[model samples]
Target: MAEKEWGRLPEPPREVVLRVKRYDPERGRTWWQEYRVPTYRGMTVLDALLWVKENADPSLSMRYSCRMGVCGSCGVVVNGVPRLACQTQIAAVASRENPVVTVEPLHNHPVVRDLVTDFTAFFEKHRRIIPHIVRRDMREVEEAEYEFLMTPDEHLSIYQYSLCIMCGLCYSACPVAASDPEYLGPQALAQAYRFIVDVRDEGYDRRIAIVDTEHGCHRCHFAATCSAVCPKDVDPAAAIQRLRRIVFLRRLGLWRKRKVAPLAGPLEKPLRRIRAEYPRHNLVEGADPERQAREPVDIDFREEWLRE
Candidate 1:
């Protein structure tokens, strides 16, 4: 254990001040505690906390798993900005000279302990939206009927919102959520949009009653901060805007739900399925059946579908 025996470590660990906020619910008090953590290259903020818990202070508490960013459990406020602790590099927010990183719990949620916040309310709001595909037919939902199909364009519309990991960083960054807990907030609204426009989902109308309420989509001020802080790159603000537009369009008389051409109709299959099974009508939704009826032998079912 001689100093010289450990020949000048190629990447010497540097000391950084971790100014962590400590809160005790029983005592009803909060305080900042500082620890000097040896930060090396590629070390994350979560790594620093873990190191302190192991070597420095055993009582130091924080919640994390997957050490990778996917679990969404390591969200914390670093230097006044909410971000995932596992993904934030310590050096990126702290330096050798001014090596102080202020770590606190996420803003909006009630703190469970040192760095863990109670996600009950956030999850309740999420659940209130019924974040799932809703089908009108009870038999089809309970048992398999046919494959739920979607075009690539339809997939693209909701895919971005679907990427949300429910990290709550968006909730932390939202001014509305911080001030008014009643608001459905960006996270819930964006997820509602994920199901709303989905071709395979039939629950849009049901969710509309919830999202169009007082503390719902209307309350968002388009601050765009939610999208900015999202770790998943899901643009929640844009989704809310699109949701508002859809509500307004439906209010007026445009944009009715497209008639679903039944699979059991005259054309035993959709033109796209036929083309995929046969050859090229090669297009988005396979060139609307009504628009082209060039040949009487074309096996068109527009007349039948349109009548319904």
Candidate 2:
């Protein structure tokens, strides 16, 4: 018997119109340019652009370092949706009435050439938050006497945020970034939360003021448009909301007192055993109430804070 393949590719009349937005800074002009490229199975938007650049238009330009979605460089607005060019397939964006999927530089950022946009403002916002682990005990942190250890649950808290490639899709999708250049956009805000939740990072006190400002988490209207368009499932809107909760809880003095962050090495407790305890307010007033007498309480911060 002959060996059989599980799948076969579609026959080649797979052609689509790639309408790209172009800009020439020197001539001070911008326009829509179209190209008809023969698509194949697994052909991405980046792949289509490469085929055009190699076969059709050498003048066309875009920035893409890793063809895979690692480097976070090839961010563009496709079909009015912000996404990673290399990750979006031609077949995915193609449709009957609008067979022509549009490609353009990120809307909020200044276009450098054709498909590339300037990241100066994007990176500056990232830097403003001081996105790094900071500890007052310089000796323990800098000398690496011991490593800060975290439970599996603790690590998972911010793991989704660490996946952000800083592709700027969220920033482009945000109406806030476009109108207020000084606003710390969703990408940086998400990153701020990534470290803020980490057991290893002690930078919360240092970073809180930066994110608690008028241009910070307070500015997010919870439209969640940033979360909707993020290629990486980093829920920036949720992060901002959590930041607000942290700040508000602190002001009310209801935040659970955290134990000193644990340090693990050859001689230390296991990570899971090192977790800080939950707030006392969450616990029932009576201990082990008669078999079925106890019921879970619905605790609200506003209500609890006013309680004596």
Candidate 3:
């Protein structure tokens, strides 16, 4: 038997009007531009937008690196809902009666162009949360001694929050973000909770201090809009609420502390000896072994500052 095509739409290619909110910086104006395009089976919003750019207007501007939903670059407001264009099928959103599909730049962001929005502030908020592992001992972290291991249950605890692609969709749909400029936003707060629950992390005090301010996780009112619009189902609203509860419980001396993951001891055997199938080369023919053995150089400023 032949393999069934899952993405195939029942109907054939049909004409649909793509209404885009276009912004021209040079003209200092924004307007709606419509284009009639043919939509085929398995066609996505991203494909439709690409068709519009290629056939209707070549001057259209947008940011999309990986055409899949993993990059989170093609996030836009479709019919007032924030979604990833690459993941949203045209047939799912459009109908026979209403053949118009409206595409606009994500809300709560400065419009860079027709469909591009500036992510400078969005990334800055994410950076404020310090979205990385933080340990109490800097020397243990820097030395290539042993790896900190977490149990299966502990890893799954923070795995959901770690799926955030920084798409800004949740931020766009957040009511608090719309009203408050200084709010850390759902994306940052969700990440704050991600590392907070990690068994290997020890920067809870520092991170909590940053997020306990006036415009921090406390500002979130549990609207749940962020969770509804998230493509990855990160449930940022729940994370924020949990974050607030953690702060409250800690203040009241009711917070329960869990044991951190233990570090691995010295290896009994060489890595290759333990795992015989481990790749010896860089997956390339005639690759230099010395160059491959060299560790990647990266700047880590967390150890430079004195503990508070």
Q: Which candidate number maximizes TM-score?
A: 3
Model 3 pairs in collision: none
Write candidate 3's Cα lDDT for 226-269 as tens digits: 99888888999899999999888877878755776668877554
User: Candidate 1 clashing pairs?
Assistant: none
> Which candidate do you rate higher for lDDT, 1 or 2?
1
Q: After superposition, how far is residue 171 of candidate 3 from its true place, in Å?
A: 0.2
User: Which model is ahead, 1 or 3, in terms of lDDT?
Assistant: 3
Q: How well is each residue in 228-301 modelled by candidate 2, as lDDT tens digits?
A: 88877888989888877887786687754264467776643322322233444455775454432344444333
Worst 10 residues of 3 by lDDT: 269-278
**What TM-score would you give candidate 2 relative to the actual structure?**
0.80
